[model samples]
Target: MAHRPDTLEHAPLGRDSAYPEQYDAGLLYPIPRAANRAPLGIDDDKLPFVGEDEWHAFEVSWLNGRGKPIVAVARFRLPANSPNLIESKSWKLYLNSLNQTRFASREDVQRTLLRDLAAAAGGSVSVELLGVDDSELVPQRLPGECLDDLDIDVSDYTPSAAHLAVGEVIVEETLYSHLLKSNCPVTGQPDWGSVLIRYKGPKIDREGLLRYLIGYRQHQDFHEHCVEHIFTDLMQLAKPEELLVLARYVRRGGLDISPWRATPGLTPPSPLRLARQ
Candidate 1:
């Protein structure tokens, strides 16, 4: 979906706010997903794929009942059908509020987060708080074939599905690229990420897919929107019988957002933190 020029004006992004040191759920901002989905011809009832957004908060902290500081990592998984998404800047501000607040226990903190975030998202959001020492917090690489070594001329910056091609042969494969880059809708700041494409259908032309992915270099949109665009493009162009599109973006403001879309019957992949994240 193309960037909505007016949405940024209503959001707290590219602006300042009174950061609360106390736990205040009002600090969270929710942007309606329909605003962006409408442009892509994607409505709530006509979703093309099923998936979830896995978000990692690396700098989570709070004061204990005894006035001792405690730190942990947070993972939030929001379903793709959620009516809204929490703004990154607002989420960061909300998390910072917990820093000076005192909680009786980690369970209390988790309950608060689950309630506040789910209210903001307009849906049920799964929350997980892991200790800093938890081995599950280990960083892992995406499993796929890297396609960054292609030597091709890339001059076009606008997205074009014409760049996608499917050969006469049929095969199942997974392809990925670490060169995915896009600009933030509000700040125009660069967002670097990697993309993974897996499907069971006609073999996609590697060069064409790479070019299509790179065409977003100058595009300005949220990480989730870009993944939806890629999914819709491939479904229309390549017509893959079974398809999955996942984007892993680097952290910005101590938070990273990863979105994945797949066919109805297929389960989504587990979350992983790449070295860049």
Candidate 2:
């Protein structure tokens, strides 16, 4: 098991806490990204990939000037270069605080959230607030070649970069699996997710890749960090000319995090919620 870094030592992840009915930005906690990236050979100054961490807040509510409650869903986009990553539990608490606050307009609420989230993320954060009636709420299946149907025997459950054996011919392929599971660095709670990998380079052995992804079953890390780790490992071991890695985790506390990392020039995939999310 990996040791929890000092940055997460003070987070409210595993701790019991009171929910604030009043608006309070103090509820937000930002953990430095360096702490987790260090082990993966990721340096903020010279990042090998460009991506964003997409977060969906399903239970957002606020009071209007008329004292009537307004409800909506929100999407937050935090750049990968952000110096800090907001802790999910604290993010939930912060959103809960807005339940009783009155906003002059929806734009006002969005601006406030954008500013606060950007500050917490240590980078510019984009926020989109939408009504529940929006058609985007529909769930969609992940796009790629499903690897879950591969009938293979598994023995090891720990992460291993060696599993990504390469073939002689270069190819372009997108592979996905719903078996990606890791634990919380602080609480040891299971974090279940599905991962998609698209690359244009030497072919990666399918069975080996599946085994490699499932290897994270006992690994402990955040969603964003885990995605980066996968990206870094593939770039180093598989030696792909182009690669993109994205992982979508199930909703826990009305929020689901999807982190993606891709080489320059590749457009990001659509931010669609999976069936399980």
Give the whole-model CA lDDT for all candidates, comma-separated: 0.87, 0.89
> Least accurate stretch of 10 residues (summed lDDT) in model 2?
1-10
Give the distance in Å from residue 68's predicted Cα in candidate 2 to where it truly belongs. Answer: 0.7
Clashes of each: 0, 0
Error of 2 at 15 (Å): 0.9
TM-score for candidate 2: 0.96
Task: Report the number of the highest-lDDT candidate.
Answer: 2
User: For residues 163-270, could you state the per-residue lDDT of candidate 2 as single tens digits?
Assistant: 878889999998999999999888989999999999999999999999999999999889998999999989998788899999999988899999999999875568
lDDT of 1 by residue, 1-277 (tens): 2222335566678887777778778777888888888888898877889998889998899999988999989999889999887889988988989999999999999999999999888899999998877787677877778888989888888799888888889898889999999999889999999999989898998988899999999999999999999998899887889999999899998999898999987765575778888
Query: With candidate 2 superimposed using the best TM-score fit, by how many Å does residue 201's alpha carbon deviate from the native?
Result: 0.2
lDDT of 1: 0.87
Q: Candidate 2: where are CA atoms >4 Å away?
A: 1-6
